[model samples]
Target: MSKKETPLFPLRKGLHTRQAHVDLPPGTFEEEHARQGFYGRTTHLYRLHPVTDWTRIEGPLRPHCYDLNPLKPSAEEAIRLSMFGSTEAGFAPICLLHNSDVALHWVAPDTMDFFYRNADGDDVYYIHAGAGKLETTFGALTYATGDYLVIPRGTTYRFLPESGDQRYLLIESFSEVTIPDRNQLGPNAIFDPAMVDTPELEPYDATPREWAVHIKREHQITKVFYPFNPLDVVGWKGDLTVWRINVKDIRPIVSARYHLPPSAHSTFIANNFVICSFLPRPFEEEEGAMRVPFFHSNIDYDEVLFYSAGHFFSRDGIGAGMMTWHPQGIHHGPHPKAIPLSRTKDRTDEVAVMVDTARPLQATPAAELMENLNYWASWK
Candidate 1:
């Protein structure tokens, strides 16, 4: 049998004819069919500047002291401001990724009352300091410093700060966020069900309040404010509601007799990547195990680590509120000094979140501006 001849332009020329018909309305044909040449085709959206150009978008908004000073009154006020306003709320400045989808919100002491639900994306709150009660449908979860709370998509909740005062690094993923996969640790090794502490549900009764919903339109760069309280749902069921889990409860599954790898402690998973916490804990093997991460290269995904508290031995310049992105390239590990120092200690006090993406992540101009651009190619 002979092969049939395929049309040169399958979608535009072969599929549809562009003949003018007298029956059509005078302006309808032009309005609808004017740009038919590019129909049914895939296009690549291109950027004019280099991907690492941090100044390509709005420059850095404002800079504030990232450190937490318990005596600072302005720090607490910033928390109150963010609770009432969006990222625009002028409390402490929020540093966002080049892509606006991900943002790090800094909230200070006595700064509670951040009640919000993600209408567009998911948000994960990493407790940087203080203790508080998270009121959710499932119940009330008491969280302290170094804890991670994930408010799933559309899950409504409120933050009730305790008397001690608090600070937090709000990580708004803007995409569905989940526990990092445990493939590296074999089956169900990391974040086992028993290790995660699901908070007890608390019941409360009060007059329902209203909330504001903002909608973004296509091609329009403004926010449309709709005055409607989403809490209208008198009741809810299923896991769609609010919940909290303590990062401490996620016990690390270490090798009994042998030295376990860093992947042994991962706890969550997402679509294309996983999130791991390099927490403070004792090593599983040998009388003394290096508490700090060793130098290594991530061939699988781009690794982005956010330092919350404690000293990061690997990197000298790193401190709380600092973010480091180690894309797939050269090796990144603790500073040469850290390896020898960590070996002496049986455990560590460090707390950090590591995000590994199997695919390359695109940064919005916002992220580039907040990033320490000098660190882009520093590993080399």
Candidate 2:
């Protein structure tokens, strides 16, 4: 696809877009923007009950702090941590980086006896390794390795993992996660919309042994029990539902002359953060073209790269299932060895998902434990 090709852009207003809705759903649509004005795209959603049935049982808001940064190891080198494996059943997802706009988690739940609903925001689950079925009010979404699952806020769902060893990178966005506008990419959208996998509307009516739904609001959890399954929605015709997109199907836009910015690989955009994919692509072939990313500072954004698959030669010791975080105000670039190595490399099979947040992100307690205390000395 040429970079100059364009797609049809039509101004849409009114009853529905792409899909239709029935019963005049009580769920009101809201648009939370990164920029205050009507510039960025909005996510369409519906709530069965606008303002009812939600009881907030609270003791005290969970105390969270990201104000301090532990000094880096002067003589230490860059290190990687494995966020794989499962913890206690109830205490699954290990919190990693978090801020007002987003909360990132690495989870490997052994079993889910109860469903969960996040009233705070929507969730994007990047399956690092796992195969499972996500039972939600909208429908059942079968997920596997490399699937990027987007579940809207207020949606109740439970993960039924089919594999004993499951790992996931879950991004809780306080705002919606939408695809970058095709217009912005011009003709660079080599990945077709058909590659995206939406639910097939297969409603689940099974009667589970334990029918309990857990609602999470304000970082607190409350459980509601039901005699029957809660995924009883027989029909829903709206653009809102669980969505999946595998990295394997995403065709990255690459340039052999001028290295493209991360935005060229933008997969999903949120309020203060944007998710991008770094899949297999040809290296810059131009005689002196910088094949790897140039050294730079995270002046305006906190950058996180979650290594997914393949060999990422740019960074030493970084392997699949590891994450590298360069907080705002820090400067980082490719390893010295990677530069010379790129000279002869014609292509790269690296697969990674990057989260670039506008707001400074703080590492959580769990994430801090897995940190390379001396990672700051790697550049030396």
Candidate 3:
């Protein structure tokens, strides 16, 4: 519940089902109105048509979809910077969605020569492609695709790509990034925290040379120079180290009788935002149960989804390495074509990362340049 609770009241005013996302009235659609990211009081509005049935959504409030493939560091850019080991113009992480709580960026970095320290917030990087090793204050850890690597704020680190291939969906949270404590589901609901791969202290062998540590605060960069290698820590001990969990290790909670809400898939919680993993899972199998996502306005939070792989059941014309943003005040759910398509399906192979921000996210000019303007028409 939020600071102000909606009095413990339950009332049904319309011709609706007793349970949400279950058997629906004929020729009717469902829209979920939730509070506090679906944990608080909610209402399932049974309607004749989905709220997304709009002819034209003008103004800046319309939904956005960005194809991030073009933004990846190209071979030309990598070859140019391979000698100097500097961040190329196109090699930098492009800020796509951001606000006070969290900022999401797309990065395909080359083997970096400089170490980075985020003085602004904690970083959670979703490995979308390639493999690499990250040397941090704690130690070094090898990273592969589909990994969620959480580096605490102020941790000095540099990502050393194995080759020229490296792409990541990086999220910088303005507050502490912690695991969601599943009160009733127990601590080991989706995954055990102990299962997370942590870095082991290893001597980072490097010749004596001047190293630059780039610190970012308020989105401004400041370089701090050191005579010797900054990652020359011999020993360390702490729980607050760079750790990661891969999507393959995630065991999604599923139900065949009822379709679970997004909150049921909560993976990580932060200040004013939450991160979720939408991995492969079985769909609702009970007859008459809604097989697709119900239409809904987040009401308070802005929604962002990064498609990692597999076919996203609720949408169409979207593939891996793509992103979609649905700000508050709009009702978006499954595309019209998706409802019938899902009825013949039993399980989904989709893998995605979802971020719900309490504050709205502004698309950067870099992200706007990669926008698919016809995304709004896909719902038709």
Q: Which candidate's TM-score is highest? A: 3
| lDDT, candidate 2, 110-211, per-residue tens | 457778888889989998877888888877778899999999999988888895667788898999888888786664475677777776657465766568
Candidates 2 and 3: which is better by lDDT? 3
**TM match of model 3 to true structure:** 0.93
lDDT of 3 by residue, 167-264 (tens): 89989899999988778888887988778999887878577888888788777677899889988888876667889999998898888888888878
- Which is superior by TM-score, 1 or 3? 3
Q: How many residue pairs clash (N, CA or C atoms closer than 3 angstroms) in each of the candidate models, in the order given?
A: 17, 1, 0
The list of candidate 2 runs beyond 4 A from truth reads 1-91, 184-190, 203-205, 208-210
Which has the better TM-score: candidate 2, or candidate 3?
3
- For candidate 3, what is the lDDT? 0.84
Per-prediction TM-score to the true structure, in the order listed: 0.60, 0.75, 0.93
Which one wins by lDDT: 1 or 3?
3
Instruction: Show pairs that collide, candidate 2.
Output: 27-47
lDDT of 1: 0.50
| Ten contiguous residues with the weakest lDDT in model 3 | 81-90
The superposed Cα distance between candidate 3 and the true structure at residue 344, in angstroms, equals 0.9
